[model samples]
Target chain A: MSQVLTIDGKDLAFDSGDTLFDVAQAQGIYIPHLCHHPDYPPQGNCKLCTVDVDGQSKCACTTQAETGMSVQTDSTTLTEYRRALTELLFSEGNHHCPGCERSGNCQLQATAYAQGMTYSSFKLLNPQRQIDASHPSVLLDRDRCILCGLCVRASAQEGKHIFTIAGRGSDSTLAVNSDSGLLADTNLSAEDRATQVCPVGALMVKQQGFRIPIGQRIYDQGTIDDLGNRRPQYHSPKSKTARIAGDSDD
Target chain B: MTESTTDSRSLTRVAIDPLTRVEGHGKVTLLLDENQVVQQARLHIVEFRGFERFIQGRPYWELPMVVQRLCGICPVSHHLAAGKAIDMLVGAEQLPPTAEKTRRLLHFAQVLQSHALHFFHLSSPDLLFGFSSKASERNIVGLLEKHPETALKGVKLRKFGQQLIETITGKRVHGSLVVPGGINKALKPAEINVYAKQMDEIIQWSTEALELAQGLYQADRKHADFGAIGSPTLSLCGNNGNFELYHGDLRVKDIDGTILLDHISNRDYLAHIEEEVKSWSYMKFPFLKRLGKDRGWYRVGPLARVLNCQQMDTPLAERARLELVNQCYPDQHQSVLLYHWARMIELLHCAESIQQVLKDSELTGGELVAPHGDRNPECYGIIEAPRGTLIHHYKVNDQDLVEEANLIVSTTSNNQAMNEAIRSVCRQYIDGHGVSEGLLNHIEVAVRAFDPCLSCATHALGKMPLSVEILSVAGHETQVLERTSQGEIQQRFYPC
Candidate 1:
């Protein structure tokens, strides 16, 4: 039941119900992604992972892998598109990479580096953003948020429903689920998946800033191309049956 | 905390503004009588970071990380001190044994690297070359050019310490590993084994450094009398009266080596010490409550810690201390210049302590953190940072949002004493005539002995202008020299 597809003129095989992102990841090909964690349901909000499939532009995260479907991941047009997307993200927020604690490890920053983006192409829109520090174990700096909705999806999957997206277009913003609109008012702990899911510096675990020194962070060692093949260390909990099966072997 | 006395009708002011060779922005203003005798000397902090005001809305857990941004040199000090304070808020009476040992090891590494930086990089340039050495030949570059091997050794030693910090906490400058209750990760067996293997090398380098410092001092007797002045010493020591750099109870010793106050809890620092604000400086002067302002002012740092401690924790440092106190300088090692010697002794202690902590088998213990309950409203965290005692106090609400904060850093603790030391040096050197470059350098050397970190002390952030002014007898400026750009220092000569 295996089928082959061509990606960037290279033949790759995948089973049924496989998305382009899943196939690419399995083939050790990095398509520069955020808002599409392997463990969480795909949101396809960020267009950084868009690929040209059969002469049509489509988000690889939302597209299904088809037999003999030709896909282009790297090209002059695609490179410019991803580069522009990275620039837009940088310009929309106050992303002072030098001052940010997550500068070295941030997915947006790493993706930009992977695309050879030396500087932003668009004018920086340094909007005044509110920093929500009402939580005991987390700090929410909206200024650095790219509004990918990973936290919103990750927390919802954990049944906490701690985050949501409000408004539309340029006015859209991240919203808290609790009545008090503070993390301390909820049962959120430092170990929550939501706290660990933010790919940016927007949602940071307090007291852990700069714990890892510069030039030694995960992304600092190598490009995402090298690290993209490895499976994520953290993932969603196993099902009840899977857990029982795993325990029997132990 | 002396006034500038600009209003004085008949006083000549010699202003060594934009003092060089220290951490951050500062100026020394000396008021002179008609005979040019020093009337008063004041050290002014020109910048303020306002960290306390901005941290208000930040969560209590973020305090440890946010406070560290206050200083790049001693970020680990603020990091650990804030962690301890937040630990109180989290209701952890004591951290897990493994967590405590890991923190101790991290702190020792920090101390080792910081002391190495202050000695080999900051102060040793003046000591190895001369206080009056040409400005062109009085920097790290000059040290590299003159004594390449020694400078390399210092760099290697600092790298060893910094690597340990990165290995344990995962970052060199501001790593976010220590949580309120405990450290996020335990020291791996492999990490400990590696550090344990390097212990002998660290010890040897530190021993050689101590010898070099002693040699430098003996070669130049003039340095001893350069900025020599005695004042009350203040520090925090363990219950056993041993030298403590990480955590301890506040202790004050008179200049004559008598314990004036002991065993005062850190929670009551505000009750025992009060800050006096001057109009000319953003920095505050901290004085003991038992004595009035003039008598209560005390000096803190390696000099105070060396003279006040009953004994060092490690055997090598203790032996070094005995030699310095009894064999080298019998008069209790009071000279400001001798602070370099005290710093070297501490460096040895840190190296030895690192070995001891790493050798402990409990370092690889499985328990990394303790259980912390609901948050409290307020708490205080205090520790002996590389500079001296640092205190972080915060008030928070039920949601863990900070409402108010107060920080008392080490350099601020020595503000009054620094001014007095500058006055003493000026009295010994400067006259009615304008200061020569050498005279200005001597004053800087006196300040450098304390290894003052004014950036953290003032908590001021943003662009700061540097200026030096010469005032006439009527307080009118005769000449004003301001640094036009940051890079201007490289082109400008220190000695004119």
Candidate 2:
């Protein structure tokens, strides 16, 4: 029999190198996440998918699944932590849902709704952010960026290394790799996989906004929990499997 | 307590703060002597919102979706105006035929719904019941209780308009449909058929509403003189001098029905109109440049449009327009109360127009965007909103961000007209009478006739409470009465 672990009191078989999040996802279980993408190496920075492993808390995306291990994905403490993390993400960014083109289809908005977050409890920063619209077809509005680094990883995977996170802590920002520090000067194209992975409205394909009317967009058709992080209509040819399986790269 | 003191020469200032049954916060102050003879009357706009300043540095294409936050009642007007401005900015001088028709459908829906809301829900209580009726019983709720069928019709009519908007744009309010050059989506045949089925019922209801408004105006001869003022009127008329709401040349007609100005392009508005700033009010007074400040002030909205336009395009509304012109022939109709009648006529026109546009096959499929031409740095977009002409001017930088924005909303155009109405009402109803609920409502009724959206004019935000105060000329409070936001009345008295 394959080595087994217990997640939320249910038995799950996992390969030796499979992470807890990977094993759970293989079993059709969802742990809320923002910084995790199946094609990229796991980054536990968001801490939204934190789960109870035995008696200690750990990020399911980064934690290795061990035989006979007991894991809990849902608990009062986990819910509070997840909700607070989502609220903090909202407070940090200028995520105006109604005005955003990604409004109904946005992952952050859908995740917030899943957490029942009507309003942010934390003080809003309303941080002034830069916009990079110099590109012919792509726009990088830092105001809506959550600094999840998915774009950074996807760009690196494509060998373009067009995006990166610069600075640290509250001063950290989504920086484009270009001599002029503008998206236009970068080699990034609208067809780049990195441009399609933005969970918010930050990295948008110019002139293609609101093309899919609201109430017909990705998240509008179903909740984030039900639809997962897949954007069916915007999937790249290389990521067809990932779109179908929600998170699996296979 | 003594008659000598009661008849003292010191003027008493009566103030109605936070006037109700209107869209935004406004106050009316009238100065009267002991005999209650009116001396001075003023309408004050108390709040200020700087939307233009904040819109700077934003991408030009975002204007249509962004500027719509100006008002909940008329977001579509702002959306269409900004879309038209952005169309010029992007150098799409003319839209695709399908795009133009789609926008026209959206605009007519907005006008139909907004007019239905104002006439049936907001002002019907005053018309159906007497204007002097008790405040508690003079509201939409009271109207519903007394006439459920009429109330239901109003609600349904508004719903149909909102539903049509949703069908076209997606959401009922603040939906994103317009893009820089044209609309984002075209209506499927099924969607157009949804509204097409309801056209006859909507047309019938609009005709009935028109009849009701006409009946009310004819029944009351006093309406002819109520808040009546003679001022020049302005609107947009097509190249053929036909009544136009979406796009046309600016036309100004004198009080005596003579064409004072015609065929003025919207792009040259600054050369013709100037806005004056006053110390007491946050709202600006826009006047015609040629006429000067004192004589330049003019009226807008349904009365102005009906008086200025040569003819209505639709057959039914054309007949209604002829009847109105015949009634007020030889002299322009200046009665503020007639605005209700004119608005109903437009509402009927919108209903008929909606049906006409839906039958066009171009709405189902065709080119949706025009090829952009040479981009312009600055441009103006002007449209006749339900209330009146709304102008949106913008200057964009090299980076395609808005460098400057100037908006003259419908209410701002009517700011001077509203103040004049307040003065007229004070002179007629409160000149020699003590402050009473009935008399105060007459002042509100006069303002309501203009349907001023103070929120849009001042670019402000917030709700209003009703408060009345009596003060001596020395600025000492003599009596104070307040109606809280929760609709509770509280009174306090002070000896002068």
| B-chain TM-score of model 1 | 0.90
Off by over 4 Å in 2: A231-250, B1-10, B20-24, B452-464, B484-491
CAPRI-wise, candidate 2 is acceptable
Q: Across the candidates, what are chain A's individual TM-scores?
A: 0.89, 0.92
Top TM-score prediction, candidate number? 2
What's the TM-score of each model vs. the native? 0.82, 0.93
Error at B473, model 2, angstroms: 3.1
Residues B244-282 of candidate 2: C-alpha lDDT, one tens digit per residue:
999999999887888999999988888889999988887
lDDT of 1 at B74: 76
lDDT of 1 by residue, B223-279 (tens): 667667667788889899999987788888887778888898867888889998878
lDDT of 1 at B116: 86
